[model samples]
Target: MIKTKCFFCKKSYTIDYSDSQYQKIKANPKAYYVCKKCNESMQREAQSTTGLDMDVIDKYDKFLR
Candidate 1:
């Protein structure tokens, strides 16, 4: 069975689709498993935000490029 548990809020849904949906989401295929509520909250935050900043090690990773 496909687990639909959103890694963010840990909310389980009736449909199990995230794992199988990784390819359809983005070019890198990095899966962010977030349930509906948390997903909506993140969406709101993203919409209100501007330039993104990489945290610590993430900054180093970008420094390589």
Candidate 2:
């Protein structure tokens, strides 16, 4: 596991070193990690503010993963 800090919350967390997301972050200096909690909160906020369908957001989120 690799130790890293969350981009939004600045909390420390661990991730698998070989994870694709870690590789992407390694390749891009500008890309920072967001912990799952922060990501979910942001997603919920976006859904509430934009009034977008949950299914649409879910589908897009899954596609990114």
Candidate 3:
């Protein structure tokens, strides 16, 4: 089990290697793992914001390239 701390909420959680892509994440320094509650709240906040969703825009741009 790998113990991880949520960057947003400062919560400590454990990741089971069998259930999560722990090794892949460990290989990438830029990769992050957030708690489910924090992730859901962030998504909700993003949806409520005005203007284009930068996350979607970035994906679309990548798709076009």
Candidate 4:
């Protein structure tokens, strides 16, 4: 498992995966894994902040959250 800190919440979490899954996630520089609560909270916050549906934002942007 790799320990990662959430860019928004500043909380640390672990990612446990097989070698193939790890490689795939590692290949993507923008890959982020946040805890379930944070993910839900961020989505709601994004919608409220932008005054638009969550679909309008590009979830892949590392800096968006």
For lDDT, the strongest prediction is 2
Error of 3 at 11 (Å): 0.7
Where is model 4 poorest over a 10-residue stretch in terms of lDDT? 18-27
- Candidate-wise lDDT, in order: 0.52, 0.75, 0.67, 0.63
What TM-score does candidate 2 get on C-alpha atoms?
0.69
Ordered by lDDT, highest first, the candidates read: 2, 3, 4, 1
Per-residue lDDT of candidate 3, residues 1-65 (tens digit): 77777778988777776634467557763467777788768866886785556567577644432
lDDT of 2 at 7: 90
Q: How many backbone clashes can be found in candidate 2?
A: 0
Candidate topping TM-score: 2
Prediction 1 global C-alpha lDDT: 0.52
List residue ranges in candidate 1 displaced over 4 A.
Answer: 16-32, 51-65
Residue-pair clashes per candidate, as listed? 0, 0, 0, 0
Off-target runs (Cα >4 Å) in candidate 2 are: 17-20, 28-30, 57-65
2-56: candidate 4 lDDT, tens digit per residue? 7666666878766667432345456663576566577779878987888877554
Model 3 poorest 10 in a row by lDDT: 56-65
Comparing 2 and 3 on TM-score, the stronger one? 2
> Which TM-score value belongs to model 1?
0.41
Error of 1 at 33 (Å): 2.6
